[model samples]
Structures are given as structure tokens and as C-alpha cells.
Target: MTALEIKEYIQKNGKIPYVLESIGCSNIVYHDNKDYYSCSNAVGGDCNNPAAINIRNNKYLNYRNYTRGVEYDDGKDLISLVQYNKNIDFANAMKYLHKLLGLKNLYKVKEEKKKPDDSWFVFSRFVVKRRKCVVNDFDPMSEDILNDFVPYIHIDLFREGIIKRTIKKFGLGYSYRWRRTIFPIRYWLDGTLMGYNARSSIENCSEFGISKYFITPGMRKEINIYGLWENYKDIQKAGYIVIFEAEKSVLKRDSRMDPTGGAIEGHVLSDEQVRIILGIGVEEVIIAMDNDVPIEEVWNMCEKFYGLRKVSYIRDKWKLLGPKDSPADAPNKIYNFLFKWRIPYDESKHREYLKSLKKNS
Candidate 1:
């Protein structure tokens, strides 16, 4: 009869006849691919169309099907579209049935449909209107380095002589990256375990690891902020972050990857993502860079981060970087560049940033 009625019928009889098509009921699609409609964003077939906002947005599109969010759901079967073969966890069941009934599709556009253009460089080349873009090239050294390794896991950080020499001096579980870098990813308030930071140990290497990605894991939007998992005290005393290209650069006493990235690294942080990070309550940012890029690039980056707060750069921090420029290369020097600079932020700069974003967008 209606979207809500169809849901009720299915809930009551465990099935709804084909007449449910008006309210948008179609077969549940399930496959092993990662694109499985396993989340609310992947809400299945009867998804609402903004153009036809008054109608139900079923997971299924009649003539033009979007396979992006299809998956099987026969009574909570996440992997196959069979009815009630077995009981599944609440989370798994919700993920599966959400795709089957396609309840979540009404809220928004599909992710792939909203993706930015494939043209242009992956991160910073495009304009983002909100705050300065924190998106940067994965590896922005002046030149390219050999990057031919990919492992789901790594063990070099724990080799025999390496950990011993450092552990005896720094303490057990002291964070380090690459060959000789270490940073503060430990407890801040009492005994709470904050994550550790480390950098790769190689000279002129653009990427320290298999991927030069930023990760503040164990953080879910419902639970925690990205950069503020714990150790807010250190973050508070510091006033704001000296946003570097990598996670390794947070601690003044730690090593940061891409210290020379400056503005070239896409240091602009969006107001939405920033508001969440700042909601943890830090004031502003002091972007640090390495000698790998030009000063104008850094200024361009600052232009993107317009609305949040003031941003400044460390003068000679990029110059101090060693051959590899990872935290493991020269831990202390990395910290020197981060703490030495601070700038105030104003929102006006965001106008050009937003305009550029819209044009390129």
C-alpha cells in the first residue's frame, strides 16, 4: 500500500508480493564485493529520488539500476539473498535487511554518484569550500621515490637490535616509524593508551609506508573524533595542532612525515571535519612543512583553511628535514619545526577557497 505499509507487511508475513513495486520492493541483492549495501548509505532498492522527492526511494531503480549498493538479504543473510537461513547478529542483520528493504536510501544520494571528478590530482588540486582542504597528495616530495611495497602487516618496527636500543632508552612501546623515528602516541591523562606514531626510515622516499595515509583509527563518528581519541590534555596545552601531512608529526617531541609539505600537502581542513575535531576543543592549527616544496605552495594551503581559525607555518622546519624526511630520520628536528610557528585564522579566506572548489567542483 505504502512504503511504511510494505515494511509492515514484510515484517508480518516475512514477504511482500510483487504489488509492493509501487512502494519500491525488489529482490535483495547480495554478493561478496565490498560495495555490498551493508550500511545505511547503501540502503537498498527503493531509494528515493530527489527529483521525485515525493515518492519512495526504493533500493531498486526501475530502468536504471545502480548496483553500487546492492546485497543479499533473506532474513538477515548478509552474504546471500535467502530468507532466514540462519540467525545473525543485530549489527549484521540490520546491515543486511537495511539493504533488502532499502529503507535507508531515502535520506541521500549514493556515494559513487556524489564522487568528485576523476580528473585532476587525487587530493589537493580541487577546491573544497568549507575550510582549507586538509587533503594532500599521498606523497608530495619534490621528486618521486621508489614505492613498491604493500603489506597488510609489517614487522620491521620490531626487529631485534632496533627495539632494544630504543626501548631501553625511551620506554617499552615507545612509538617509532621507518628506521629511527619515534613520537608521542602514549598515555596523556592517567593510564589511557593513546595510539603511537612512527615514520619510515629511508632517504628521499616520498612514502614512508606502503601507503602515505592518515589514520586515526578506533574512532567512529558516533563515538570519538578523528585526531582526538584521548590525551586531550596535551592537545589542550598545545592550543592547536601543527597539521602535518602524516600522523607521525603531532608530538613536538615526535617525528612527523612530510614536514616540508607546507601548503603543497593540502593542509586545508574542512569545517565539518574540523568542527568535529575542534569540538574536542583545541583552538587552531600551525601547519608545518618540509623543504621539499616552495613557500607559495604552503600559502596556497593556508588559503584553503579559511574559516576555522588562524594558521601559521614554521619558518625553517622544512629545511631541517634529512634525506628521507620521516620521523625516524631526525625525531627532534621534526618537533622543532612544528612548535615554532602559530598564526591566527579568519573566515574571509574561505571565499576564494569555496569559489575555487565550486568551479573545479
Candidate 2:
């Protein structure tokens, strides 16, 4: 059946929770008053502390497997939930759902329409030529372009424990027109201007329909590592690197943790980023994502550098961090303590430790 038909069928029949159970999800518990059901994460198996995954009104699914750094905050439909949990493409997921529901996998057919003709193109000389449009690649911006922003520091950075020296060191700027703080993104190997990340300074900016971050068009934050330009030497000298989620986390740390760098955009590292880190020749990799990120997710990141480098991670097992706090968000002593006691990544040991914590709790 078509995607919409399958979705409607599941919701109308109240089969979302049943689908979860069918897909190997265990410990399914429904909340009578809230009209929702909670279950252990489908991917990680049943947890003594269940509720990492939930379904609301049998239509929307919310799954947060922090250990895996996988979260579906916005509710997902049954098809999407199946696709994600089962690691299958849309067609296969639909087919699986059909099988589970005891239905046939009959796809909807499209109405016939006139097709475009591409046999030949009339040119000035009556030649059969198909013109190909070549898109231009974006060139790197220059440091001189930063002159556009005012050379003034915003108070928000300071409130976040960013010192004046670090601000000036990074050449932070302010945009008068946009009312935002400007952060210049640069190439890591050689300091060349790449783009600017403009952060909204206005309080409750989202309420006013202003986005928190406005990055430069054509800027691929995924491929590059922020602060790598400034901290590459430190990372090499220290024999390890600490990877954080946000750029500010890299700037707010003790200068000693100069080896720390931020993932330009997200908690997950891209293939190119992993390659770059491997090329850096560091002996150890410390995945120090934010507190909200589960150790399981961090452990998954460790797989990238599994045998190539010694992998370790910082987790708030002692309850030092807030719900969404970064290790760098804490004071120097706390950050240092967490860093010093970072757990070395061992698949078997980590799983056992997680089980132990669940058992004790």
C-alpha cells in the first residue's frame, strides 16, 4: 500500500504499540491517565529503567536513547518509527509493516502523464547539443571581510564564562543590524576564513521568530572541525583530543584543555571529521559531548576510533552536570575532575557497567 494508507491503517487500528512489540521492543507499559505507552529503547534492548521510548495517542513516537546519541524529539509516525528502529529503507519498512499487519505489499500506481522529450536540442547551427550547466564552487572568505562586524564583545559570551582574552583571541565580533554575536569559522590546517556563525543576542529570540544561529550559506559545518585551527598543535602535543558539541564549549575551557575542539555543527562526527582526527595522529580520543548525551551514544562514537586510537569519554556519573550542561559549562575544578576520571571505552566493560548501574538504581 501507499505510505499514507499504511499510516492511516496503523493509527486507525491502534497498532503503534503492537508494532513496537512486534519489532522486538520489550517492557511495554501504558500510562492510563496520559493516554501514552512507554517502552525500552527498541535498538538497545529492554532496560530496567524503561521509558526511553514512548508512543503518544498511538500516532506519535518519541524515542531518546541517550547512550546511542539517538533521539526523536518531534513525534514520528509508525512508518518512520519502524524505519528507524529496524534500520530499513522506506520500501522495506513498509513491506515489514505490511507483513506484521498481515496485509499485501501492493504499492499505489501513478496516473500516466506526458514525458519530457530530450532526444535533441535545437542550437544556432542546427547542432544536437544538450547544454550542461556547471555550478560554481564557493570560495573561502578572507579575514579582511570580518571588518564588516563591529569589534565589540557581547555580554552573553561573558555570562557563559567566556573570558575577554579568549574572545579577542578568536576575533569575536558583533553585528549591529542583526543584533547577533559573530563567530568566524576558519579552515583548520591553515587559518583561512571559511564563514561566519551569527548567534542571536536578543533574549527570547525564538519567540520573535529569530533563529538562534545563522550560518553562512554554502558553509558545510559537518566536514570541518571548529577550534581545530587553534588547537591542532595542542591536540598533537597532548596525545589526545576532547570533542565537544558546540564551539563555545571549546572557548570556555581552561587553556590547559587547549586540545579540546568542537564538532562544527553536531554531536555526531562526520566521516571526513573522523579521517581528519585519525590523520592528526593522536594516541587517544576523548568524546566529551554534553551531559544530555548518553554514554551509550558516546560509546558508539568510540567505534570510529576503536582500534586506531585509545578511546575515552567524559560522563556525569557523579551528577555534577545539569540536564543539558557540558563538561566545559562547569567550573574549572569540576571540568578537570570529570576529565581526569574519563572512562576508557571498552564495549564489554561499558555494557556491563551500564547494566550494573541499572541494577543498583
Top-scoring candidate (TM-score): 2
| Per-residue error (Å), model 1, residue 44 | 48
Model 2: per-residue Cα lDDT over 1-361, one tens digit each: 3354555677778787788888777778878898777777655644554776666654334444544465544323456567767877444675687788876433322323334544442111111111111111123553555666787668877787777777777788887866888888776645656677788889998898778887776676765788887777767777888888888888887333454565546777776577557545567888989899866567668777776678888889999989998888888889889989998887775676568668768
Runs with alpha carbons beyond 4 Å of true place in candidate 2: 1-138, 254-259, 347-361
Flag regions of model 1 displaced more than 4 Å: 1-227, 251-272, 293-297, 304-307, 323-338, 341-361
Error of 1 at 356 (Å): 11
- List per-prediction Cα lDDT, in the order shown: 0.34, 0.67
Evaluated against the true structure, the overall lDDT of model 2 is 0.67
Tens digits of lDDT, candidate 1, 53-83:
1112232211122342432221112112222
The 10-residue segment with the lowest total lDDT in model 2 = 122-131
Residues forming the 10-long window of minimal summed lDDT in candidate 1:
137-146
